[model samples]
Target: MTAQANYNYSYDLNNNIFYSGERQIPAYELEENEIGTCEKCQSTILSLSYHEIDDEFIVTGKCSICGNISANIYGHEWNWISEIFISHFFGQTPAQTTEDSELQIPEARKSLKNEDNGIDDLELLNSIPMNQIETIFSPTEIKAMFARAKGEKCVRQYLYNARKKYKTFEDVFGIKIDI
Candidate 1:
């Protein structure tokens, strides 16, 4: 079986949501300000498919006028839950970082405040030597490390769910992740 098949997740094209068993997970959508332009014929309509394991999106635009097909692959750092939840559901605008000041939403502002006060848990875990990681960090922190390594944002819900797989991570990595 493919590695992606091991994950019990599927996307609903009609509703634009992801499902892991019965759990409804957020899915990415084209932003109001964003436009999909077909390179070949300049068409505006496009069909997109997201590949979760690779964190890549395949965009296809078929021009009705010119009968030209345009396809592209977008990769790197794009996530469904984090992006959709913050941008769509919460109706929060993306933060803009400028030379003098950075404008962030309330949630991001809170996280920034916390980071300013002390080292982030994820950062600390990443800095620790691999040989000493299991010894230095707690099981939860270790799980967060694994999730981060897998390209997930270290959000609380993701971290909490990941912590339960501490044993699995330990077995795979041959490290004794402790509480």
Candidate 2:
């Protein structure tokens, strides 16, 4: 899925937070505020329904007072809070995890090697918002970087070379990326 063109709240990419005017709003609060009132009449009485499309979750609210309907879409990364709000709205308990699992270093290493040999890196890079990518590197620079990284013969070396700029990508995009 592509990044949303218009969002209900403005996002501060540098700070990795959402805000409306001056007040900072968490994901849950932003979602709640979005569906809390009618867009046309500002009425609190709304009948809401949820839908999933690929990696996005959409909440549709119909205002009882003005009969105005609005739909808000959220990305998968915000599911941690959206799931809780969804469950509550539907009168269901949120799923709970038993314990945190330890990371398997060997499996991670193998996965990185596999991705290095395939087009996964390109795909992963494309998954990021184009605006964010352009902020860090131009199209010509990115093409050159990929060509240079692919010249490495060893899988470990290739992986390291390819991911050399990942830290910069993470810092600018405000998302943890493994590719």
Candidate 3:
């Protein structure tokens, strides 16, 4: 039999299924804003979602019951993961370990807060009637919906819209990245 027939959540023909060599995350390390309950099966989550390109975490040994879904936040996606570090693990950076600090960026969800909570104007929204609440998001799940009214998002758009707040590459993003 070929590798596909033997492939599992731990290994494959060309890749490791557990994704160990690159980033060995414990089953407890859930992705950002991905805790609590499952929206689909309503089952209590046994483990956290892995934040890898095209990454999938199976609830069943064969991934039968349900799975934790995830995506890559990069131009290259899966390919980019090869070049990226397994982040938010160990609480240690090249600088120092602020693991005890609760306000740390990785420790907070939706921590990169700007004025918009999809509630462009909270006062205006509150003044409206309940039936019109659909105009506002309920924040039931994911709290995620990209600003798709326009075309695909560009890094420049995020940079420009953010203004003076969007300072040098290092300040805006706590990372020193090279292209």
Candidate 4:
């Protein structure tokens, strides 16, 4: 039997090894050799998951940029849960610099308010880290996402379409998509 198999065979503390205890360890574990990386922000991984199936590890997670599993992380399992939940489920990724979210807009301050002078998307875009940008999308995929953004009729039409590209969304959108 392989070392992995041996580990599963028994929980012999005498051997200085332990079967990730239920409470002490995460409910799930890594199964595959590697998982994809994040679609947004290449800084940190978008998701990392593992599961013990038939006695082995299946792990997956992505970088902030492509949601492509660029790196291989080996260690504790639960450590990544928090990050996955925050980024994959929610759009929030850990900020690089600590900009106060609560900063108040100056009441008297006005930004040369004019129709042509729109808010600087480029400034915001520049401020956005390369890692935060969503990974690229295919023309068909882009069309589907656009449909969803349009309305519920589109959402229903694209719901299954979205699921079909489950892995692709992470690759392009940098977000975990579960239908």
State which candidate, 1 or 3, has the greater TM-score: 1
For each candidate, the alpha-carbon lDDT, in order, equals 0.37, 0.38, 0.26, 0.31
In terms of lDDT, model 3 sits at: 0.26
C-alpha TM-score for every candidate: 0.21, 0.29, 0.18, 0.23
What would the TM-score be for candidate 3 when compared with the true structure? 0.18
Error of 3 at 11 (Å): 9.4
- Model 3: weakest 10-residue lDDT segment is 1-10
**For every model in order, what is the number of clashing pairs?**
0, 0, 2, 32
Error of 2 at 167 (Å): 1.4
lDDT by residue for model 3 over 1-179, one digit each (tens)? 11121111121211212333343423323333433353335544332243333253321111113332212222323222211112112222222223342111221222222243221122212222223223232332101222221222435544233332323322422322111
Scored by lDDT, the top model is 2
Candidate 4: where is the Cα deviation over 4 Å? Answer: 1-49, 68-145, 151-179
By the TM-score metric, which is better: model 3 or model 4?
Answer: 4
Which pairs, if any, clash in model 3? 10-17, 11-17
Better of 2 and 4 by TM-score: 2
Name the TM-score of candidate 1: 0.21
What ordering of candidates by TM-score runs from best to worst? 2, 4, 1, 3
* Candidate order by decreasing lDDT: 2, 1, 4, 3
